[model samples]
Target: MRPSSTLLLVLGLSSTLTACGGEARSQASASPVVETTVAEPQYESIEQFESAAIKRDVPYVPTPQETVDEMLRLAQVSRDDLVYDLGSGDGRIVITAAKKHGARGVGIDIDPTRIEEANENARTAGVTDKVKFVQGDLFNADLGQATAVTLYLLRSVNLRLRPKLLAELRPGTPVVSHDFDMGEWAPDDHKRVGDDDIYLWIVPAKVDGNWQWKDAAGRSIVATIEQEFQTFTGTARADGDRYNLRNGRINGAEVSFELVRAGDETAPVLERYAGKLANGAIQGRITAGNRQAAWLAKHD
Candidate 1:
């Protein structure tokens, strides 16, 4: 028999013959003294084992509870909110949002171990009805139903997710992150908790391209807008005159700017425009001098 088979047989015989006579003991002792060894599990490295078992893009790191509170606070989570937490280790952020703010939440984690732990945590927190833990890739998870989002991922991961966040989330949805910030895409608010950093961003509406609206005098007003994230600069042409856009800013779907006739800095005529962007049109009001009128602009 092979050495392994011999080892198993010997072990079996030894157990059965323990109460046998001296002859049996002698027979067993005379049998081959086969040396056996238990081979230890082999791995290339600790990292390899972790990679195979966890398959996580970022190592599991739990955000501090205080930082979690601050993140929800920064996002202004409320009962009306449905928060989605990506790479949600232990599901603390979403659970806290549910427990304290009365918000419903979803947590996504790539690791099944983490998802299990997060689900158990939610159960212990008595918020299982308000939150759920999903084992899935955060990159492909559906976020369209979320009113608020939270992240505790690396900067590279956040960058990879930036486009998805913008594409899937509705304008005015709040996104809060711990430690890392979306590169180049600045946060609307930031705060420091203990030694950790918390950041908040309000999803901005896409407002690039030409926008056209007529003034009260019924002259044709065509404004060309150039947008980079939430800030934009553009020029408006009405009749045969060109005007410059100043202080152009977009907060969520809300748009505000000042239109000044070019080269009229000495006593520039300023038309302050404020509006909400929806569909392909903006609807709000324009203020000039002491007169205010409905402002409607459509993207062209």
Candidate 2:
């Protein structure tokens, strides 16, 4: 049967629409569903995290401003002094030293956050020119250039750091600690600020050996010194006569002691010897009553 053109056109259009609809249904039915997933967070061990984090020997504790001022005072911080504040939390100690005492200062801290905070504080205090902040472990810091040091660390930390302080700092350098002290290493001075305790120590010179010098009367004097920290005991021999040292003390490079002639209980002859130690030699004066004379000593 021959169909009309209009009917044929209609038939073709209908077939095309049906085919398109069927293909669209087939595509929709054959489509695969998509599923969503969330990942779980992974955490490392506490020790591993701590190793990656900032290592602090002592916890961060801000020193009171009053205590800071007292610490600087106890250390006798001057404009010529280069003060170092170890374990500086917000750099208050060093900043206070620079601002109040017109001194130069360095602050060492392990935490970067604290280092940043301290730097900002120094800037605000207008002492940036005289102060600097360093992010590092205090134990590993170089303190040779420091004339004074301040600490607000734990007792254990202070004990652990005592050797480094004594080794690096020059003799006569003053060290001040807030609320904690070096075990068995007595403080040269101590003061109370409110409820906080401030302790000071002067680095002692190494003068524990034989020292020889000439007395006022052209007599040769030989001294044997045995020192434990700043206090010492020894005996001096001159002209075949032995004298026992009394009240022997060393403060930095300054050494002083009194000599009393041995075997003389009553009416003992007393001589006071005072000297400054440098280049392994002592240049000082001996005072016997109203008379004073020059004295020189060399470590042997």
Candidate 3:
């Protein structure tokens, strides 16, 4: 797995539902101390058979050819996007993404045969120069350069990958999925593709850091909050009482969010504020009770 990247955009990404890897072999105390080798499961093609086993979802349906085309359209994948297809069945999505959109793609699947087949398919589609396939655990795959993602996995698996998807991919990167919906998380846009509904989500930027603000009374407030990807729980004390700030998002150079004075819901400070980060400081305007003020911020 690659290191997590930054989510620097907020396009009001659909909120996702709440949801690591190591390989080791242990010796068994059996007859004659035999060195038993347990081989990892491998498959030639990730067709419905293997997919059902890994995903444990029977009767999995592959995206229809026309549906794939529509998904590419909905995702807005262009010549600039690096599309990554998880559980790539036959590399159809990746091949089509590169061939039709002039984009690049990487297909990750656990079946070596599928990888080889995908590579061959790409060559046949005349997009081999732009599409590549890797045989490995999708959970361990690197998604550092992915500008867009397409998936046809189960809801549980989708939910499990939510954090990694948000933490690794840059904010605003579009994700397209077929049929099944991500639990609790609504899609930014959804449309019917033939008889199926395709969903799209733009990843929201991570919100954390030092920001400066000024109240309508001309009082300056510089607050710093440490963050962990999507959700941030930080404290910014004011007037002898600690104010708890929650929910923040950083989109490119702009940062906007909410905060409460201390932990008390009734004691509110600056209900909402919007600001932008420039150079090494945060400067923006705040709105509260028909009051507006400009604030400046520097890293603490």
User: Candidate 3's C-alpha lDDT?
Assistant: 0.71
Top TM-score hit: 1
Cα lDDT tens digits for candidate 3, 201-256: 87755456665555556555657787644335666655554567766655545667
Ten contiguous residues minimizing lDDT sum, candidate 2: 1-10
Expressed as tens digits, the lDDT of each residue in 99-151 for candidate 2 is 99999999998887788789999989999999999988898899999999998
Best by lDDT: 1
- Comparing 1 and 2 on TM-score, the stronger one: 1
Alpha carbon lDDT of each predicted model: 0.85, 0.85, 0.71
Runs with alpha carbons beyond 4 Å of true place in candidate 3: 1-60, 208-212, 215-218, 222-254, 257-272, 275-300
| 1 or 3, greater by lDDT | 1
The positional error of residue 2 in candidate 3, measured at the CA in angstroms, is 33
**Clashes by residue pair, model 3:** 7-205, 8-251, 8-252, 9-251, 212-297, 214-295, 243-262
Which 10-residue span in candidate 3 carries the lowest summed lDDT? 2-11
* Candidate 3 Cα deviation (angstroms), residue 10: 36
What are the RMSDs of all candidates, in order?
15.3, 24.6, 11.1
